[model samples]
Target: MTSNAENELLERYGWPIEEMDFGREDDPDVIGCAVLEEVEGGTSGIFVVRPGLDEENRTGFAEWAVQRVGRYFEHGPEPDGWQKRSDGGWQLWVRRVEMPPI
Candidate 1:
């Protein structure tokens, strides 16, 4: 299941639930959440510029996203940062982050 914070991240990016094949009426957290790709320890998701949105805005949203790995999260730009794949999807690096539990 996706936490509220995770769902908020997707909504901020204008994530296309339907186009991504995960309907809003369904459980969209597990499959579409900003989760760590177990094999590579990375994260991936699709972002759309909607009808009124511009490319710049979409790109900004992508960069703003953070990948959640259980209780940890990772985010950055280029070289060792998150970036949009050639296919227009965004993927985060496999840099595991650890923080003291609150």
Candidate 2:
């Protein structure tokens, strides 16, 4: 189940369904993290990162989070693109593994 805020975003952004909690960063400035897995037909996962402070633009928090995930997780997805949310957060798309056809 998604939070009310998330639900609003889902409607507003037309995001893909089926999101998973990928966990948060240890950085004190970052919070409310999750990953929308297998987006775009399993080609990518989207990183949802909420910062503790108010950010006006793409302040590299998404990139920093991506780097952190890469260092902690083995063979993590690579960053494809990102966007600053209206609520002062960020959503980053990362490349995911491709599955074989059935």
**CA RMSD for every model?**
12.9, 15.3
Encode model 1's per-residue lDDT on 20-80: one tens digit a residue: 3333334322222232232245444443222333344333333434333222333333444
* Residues 1-102 of candidate 2: C-alpha lDDT, one tens digit per residue: 344444444454453233234444444334334343433443233445443323421224344443544443444333434345565433554322347999
Error of 1 at 47 (Å): 8.9
lDDT of each: 0.37, 0.40
lDDT for model 1, please.
Answer: 0.37
lDDT of 1 at 16: 37
Q: How many angstroms is residue 54 displaced in model 1 relative to the true structure, after the best TM-score fit?
A: 35
Off by over 4 Å in 1: 16-76, 83-90, 93-102
